[model samples]
Target: MGVIDWAIVAIYGVVVIAIGIIASRRQTDTDEYFRGSRQIPWWALGFSIIATSFSAASLLGGPGEGYTNGFLYLQLQLGDLLGYGLVIALLLPFFVRLNLTTAYEYLEKRFDAKTRSLGSLCFLLFVIARLGGLLYAASLVVATVTDLPMGAAILLVGVVSIAYTVVGGITAVVWTDVLQFAMIFVGIGAGIWTAVNGVPGGFGELWQVAAANDKLALFNFSWEPSSVRSLPTALFAYGILAFAVAGTNQQSVQRYVSCADEKSARKAILLGWFSGLVGVGATLLLGVLLFGFYSINGGLPADIAADGILSHFIVNAVPPGASGFLVAAIFAAAMSSIDSALHSLSTCITVDFYDRYVQARTNEKQSLRIAQILIVVWGIVGIGSAFYAASTGKDLLEFLVTYTTMFLGPLLGIFLMGVLFPRVNSSGAFYGTIAAVMLVIVGSNMGWLTFPGIWRSAITAPLGMLLGYGISLFGQIPPQRALQGLTLWHSSKQAQALGRPGLEEEVPDRGDY
Candidate 1:
């Protein structure tokens, strides 16, 4: 990389921090810090969600998967659309009407305290592993470009992300994400352009190479149970995975719930899905271009790992200034994910646990301070976990999908059981979640489950849902009073009739800036 590229990277970092500082001026309490006081425009929230989704996993891993296996991976986008639809249609009504701070709070309202606690814990495990993976992937990019040790690069990335998030909160996170998304768009466009121009006969020659190698294949209609790239897995299993992510995960739930209205939230989430599809598609195309570039040339180097190919290409093949912009995009992707996770994780700890249990009487100012402090603490812990993630020697994209399936599957099952099944009791949800997670762990270790990583959630979620519903049959049904406004079967009018609060809370108008 040349001086121009290094300068572009430096300016990007400074600008991100500046956005955080500027956003901090409007902060008056935890609401603004965590939810942007529910005043952020829908477009910003939608764009932030897309930016966070990119992470290092998509930025690097998407291309790697494309490079290695071609367009078969893009099938998962179909599942994503299905999942997003389910969440919007089935789940968002409850969340938006309740004005909940964290997604797990709904578990407590619908089920029992123990069930809520378990949900939060599952989310914690899921997001923490993701935080580590995102950080590790981004750090690998930095290390590759600057010749720094992995640990130092991890620290560098972690500190920059933590600095902005801890100060500006979600305000900083969403706005910076908007800027980062632009950088990512520019970076990926540059990468594709460079890769195409580098080929001997340009896109036509690249197309020939990709077609000859079967890299343009998109769908696999095979019914094999263990097939990871099969159409069924992408359409069905991946849909469940997407629902688990968009519907149940705190990081995702937090985004839409911050919107001023359900309509805005719905539009924002859908926009995120569409934008992410475009962004991810571009990255995958870049991967195909790389494969084409290498095939026509001498071929990819022997030592380059799947995850490292993008980084290696940027450093060696891209023009100097362009390489730096690509690096900046990678940083943008990493920080966007890290910041969102840190805020949501801290929100879980502070709202779900701390405010709910430890000191329920604390003023909003004190709670806000605690949330900020927790961000710093979790950021440090995430950095430490990144070292562990790097040692696991897994592909970045697959590594995240594996962990998401393992933890979120059962968690989403419990949420589904709560909303879709009115008969499920708190006891059933609690025990069912415990049983489902345990079985998944044991089954995978014992080699009893042999399907693709994405299939784990598809299998486990239904298992937990059925187990929960069955157990509920043997237990006392929850009173109709407690079910109001919590389940899909329960409407806001019914809640109001039963002397419960209606779906939407009337928050006083407040300035976001």
Candidate 2:
């Protein structure tokens, strides 16, 4: 890139760091650091959720999926709408009612300390793995453009994220994400305009090219187990992925808990659907455009890998200054996600581990310090993992999509049981979660169980949940007494009556906004 391009990237970086430092003033205590003292507006939080979830995966991976598979890949995203709806309808209310500081805290109250710790551990593992994949992807993009070593790029991204996150906390994360999301859209929009102008036939011609190449089709009706990309498998795998993202994932769930009440939380979730749809849809469309651009240009650069398609395009195709802006945008995507993961992981460790196990007497300031320290530690670990993953030459999308489910699916199953089935005891919930996780691992490794043949992975979590729930019911009697307690929505009402405004009121002892 030209000097102009480098300047654009540098400017974007400065703006992000500035925002974080500004937000840091508001984060004077643990609650404010972790959840922004629940003062963030629904719309801002909704956009932040979109920004966080989009990630480098969506920025690059979505287009890659489209370039290779066509519109049929969209089936996976369809499940998100349903997944978000379920979270709004069911999971949000339950979390709100509990006034949960960490999502795992609910597990502790309903089950046992072991159960809560187990859940937290699972999340911690998933976040580390997933964030490693994200950092790796971002590093690849930067390295591709600037010809830097992958390790250097990875360190640069990790340090920037850790610096802001440790200082500004969740408030910084939310506001910075808003700006990052805008930059991503700007880059994507510019790419799309350029592609459309260059192509002779516009979208119509592009569609024709895709159709001729068998990319326009959206479904494969075959039900046979042998097919890897059939309609059923896509739907089933996507459904599970959606459930994990919306209902079970701590990073996503934490955003809901950051809202003022159950009502606002639900609204934020629903609003996020529009952002998700548009963001994903644009990425996919850009993929089609990328395909046409490369096809007409007589194929991509010889060294361009499948996952590097979008990055390759940005560095080679976009104008000088704009190219750096796009590069910064990629960093923005990675940072948005990593920041959330850091905060969530720290929150889980502090609330679930330090507070519950090590020292019950710790005050809010002490807790915040502990969390900030954990964030730095995890950030280093994430960077190391990114270097390890880069050496494996794994496809970023496949590695992230498959490994994330290893733990998330079982967690989802256990949580579903806990909230939906009041009869389930701590013992049952504990054993049920374990059983579900084992089933997922066994099925994935052995390949004995398969659903929707095109989806190579086994439906372990869903099936395990089914089995675990069934096992729990064998000797347990249903509760004859009505479950007496406030639901998640009603908990908001209780908080309001108690003069909490559900989340708007800042706890004085906690400090800051």
Candidate 3:
């Protein structure tokens, strides 16, 4: 790489450090550290949410998917759209009204501590386990563009992410996301522009070639759930996953809690819907452009793995200094994601486990200290796990997504049961979760169930919820009267029972929000 490229990367690093220090100054207590003192802007939180939701997978693997599978991958994105609607219509009001610190806290008040711990356990595994895989994927770009070994690259990334997240907490993660989000767009936009123009044709010519090759094809409305990329199956899978991750996962939940009010929280989510649409579009479209680029030249680049197509193009195609920023964009995507996960992991542990079980009486100062320590510990776990990931040699993205979604269906299902179906007691929720997981494991292996691969989450999540719903219907047992505020229809009554503001404040008359 040229000196200018090196300079650009250095500058990016320096600016990130400056951002951490500035944001760090704003945190005076654990509440501000974890929830941004309810001062974060909705648009900013929306941007951060998008940044945290999709990662290097969307930036790199998306194009790779486009290059290899045509537009079949785009169908999965449709399900994610439904998640935002779920958040605005249902989840936003409840979370705001309760003024919860962690999403899992809702579970405890709704059912029991065991259920709350269960939900938190699922969230921790989903997020923490993905970190090592993310580190490995990001290191590919770092190792390609610099002299660092993959291990060292992973360490460097882990260390840098920890530094900012540990010091600035959620505020740093959000604002840096604004910067990283911008980088993602700029990098993807530049790549698309160059790839399209560099090809023998522009949009018209590229579309002709893409159409002929079916690279632009979308929505094969097949009913077979095992159809890996079918519209019906894939859409179903993504919708369930979006609700599980965006609505229930701590990573996304904490962002919602940081809003100044229920209105801002809802507005932020709406903004995220728009930003998410554009961000995903840019990545997917870049994939289409890359397909056209490679096709015009006859085939994939020589001396490159399929996953390295985007990196290969950046190295050989883009200008000098700009390439550094593009690489920075990849790192930006990676850093944004892992830092958010780390912070969320810490929040989940601190609020759900540490605070509740370990030392409920711990003051804010001690809680803040404990949270920072967990950040370091989880960061180490992620870094250490990268060593094992390198040896396993799995497709990092696929590996991460597979495991993350394994329990997602059951987890989201239980929440749905608690919120929407009041008759569903702890036993019903517990048994249904166990049955859903068992069904997924057996079906995935035996091929008895139509849902397979990533599609497992889609079918499995709703199946679990349905199981919970049906099983609870058979019972004459009702939820404890103390559990009223937690259910959707009776949130106000529950509030009255508990002497808190009833469901009225739980959901404001947010006409448009």
Candidate 4:
């Protein structure tokens, strides 16, 4: 990269840190740090959610999948779209109505302390691994451009992300996302433009190349069970992943519950849905274009990995200043994901564990201090984990992602059981999640599950839901008055059957900010 490009990257980093410091000024307590004081406009929260979703996974992995297998991967976006609708229509009401700080707190209200603790632990594991993957991916981009060791690149990315998140909390995370999202668009746009103009005959020639190679194919209507990447199966799996990530994950739920109103939250979530579709389309289009570019020029080099194609092209083909912008976009994607996870992890610790158990009764100021301390602690731990992955020289990201999926099916299932199935008891949810997890481990490793390949991924969540609900029926505790407004059906009938208004109305308006 040229000096001007390097300067842009450096200045961009400095601007993000400054945003963090400026944001820190408004936060007087844990509520602001953890909740964004519930004052951030819905549009900003929505944009932040989009930015977080546009992580290195989409920037690199999306294109890699497109390059490898054609546009069939885009089918997953259909399920993702449906998942967002489900979240806004079905999931957001309970989360927002509960006035949650960390989304897991709703589990405690609906279930038991043990269940809440379990949920929090799942969130921590999920986000920490996700953070590592983003860092690793960003490191790959740096290694491609600067010839730096992957470990060193990972450390540099991690430190820049953690620096701001530890100070400004969600405030910094959201505001910085606004800038990062712009950089992402510019970078992705640059790739698309180059792919088109670099080819001699433009869209006509690109189409001819893609058509000849069958790279434009987008489906597998065949009824094969083990074809995990098939359109139907992939769509279903992506839906499950989105449901878990958007509906049940702390990072997303924190944003939903932090909105000014349900209307704002819903709109913001819809914006996320829109962003997902648009962003995936852009990257996939790039993949198609690159297919044409390489076809006419000659095939990819023997040593160039599939993942490295985009990075390699940017470094070697694109102009230096432009390459730097693209690199900054990669960095921006990493920061978007890491900062949010740091804030979410810190909230879980402070609200779920520290405040709930250790302090039990800390004031707002005390809570704020603990939140900051946990933020720094978790940030350090996340960076250390990234360094560990780099040092081990293992393809550890995939293992962690696959391992996390074992929990996703159960985690999403438990949340559904709580919100949708009123009969599912705390004991049932706890045991059912445990059962699904154990079975998933055995089934995934042994490759003996009746459900084929990634079809198993989609099926596991419903299996978990059924297991939890069925077990609760056997235990059969009597219905109680307190169950009102916490579950979907219960909340509706509270006024008619119990002669009491909904409990959500009791969620305090803490506008003290």
Best by lDDT: 1
Q: Which pairs clash in model 2?
A: 93-488, 97-488, 227-453, 227-454, 228-454, 229-454
Task: Highest TM-score: give the candidate number.
Answer: 1
- Candidate 4 lDDT: 0.77
**Ranking of predictions according to TM-score:** 1, 4, 3, 2
TM-score of 2: 0.89
Clashing residue pairs in all predictions, respectively, total 1, 6, 5, 0
What's the ranking of the predictions by lDDT, best on top? 1, 3, 4, 2
Error of 1 at 153 (Å): 0.8
Give lDDT: candidate 2, residue 477: 44
Per-model TM-score, in order, reads 0.96, 0.89, 0.91, 0.92
Per the 3 Å backbone cut-off, how many clashing residue pairs does candidate 4 have?
Answer: 0
Residue 323 lDDT, candidate 4, scale 0-100: 79
Please provide, for model 3 over 1-513, each residue's C-alpha lDDT reduced to its tens digit, 9 standing for 90 to 100.
Answer: 688888877888788888889998887789899998888888999899889976875677877777777777767667777777887777877777778889887776666678778888888877767787777678878887786898888888889888888988899999999898998887787787787778666877777877888877777887866654787765676676777888888888888888988888888887877788777767777778788887787777466655688888888888876687788889888888988989999999999889878997999989999999999999999887767676786665577777778756678887888888887866677677778888878876797765456666666767777777677777645544425566777757656776664544432211210
RMSD of each: 4.0, 5.1, 4.6, 3.7
Worst 10 residues of 3 by lDDT: 504-513
- Runs in model 4 deviating more than 4 A are 224-228, 387-401, 445-447, 450-457, 476-479, 492-501, 505-513
lDDT of 1 by residue, 110-170 (tens): 7766788889999999999999999998999989998999999999999988889988988
Displacement of the residue 1 alpha carbon in candidate 2, Å = 1.2
Q: Which regions of candidate 2 fall more than 4 Å away from where they truly are?
A: 199-207, 224-230, 443-447, 450-458, 466-483, 486-513
Candidate 2 vs candidate 3, TM-score winner: 3
Candidate 3 residue runs with Cα over 4 Å from true position: 200-204, 442-450, 466-480, 493-513
Per-residue accuracy of model 4 over 1-513 as CA lDDT, tens digit each = 889889989989999999999998998888888888899988889889988867865687666666777787677677778778889877888788767787777777777777888888888887786777767778889887888887778777777777788878798899899899888888888877777787779878987887888878867776555553576655666666677778878888988988987888999998888887787777777788788888887878888766687887888788767777888888888789888888888899889998877997899998888887877788778877777655655433253445456555567887888888878888888888888777876876797765543444467778778788878989866245335777777764554466653655442222211
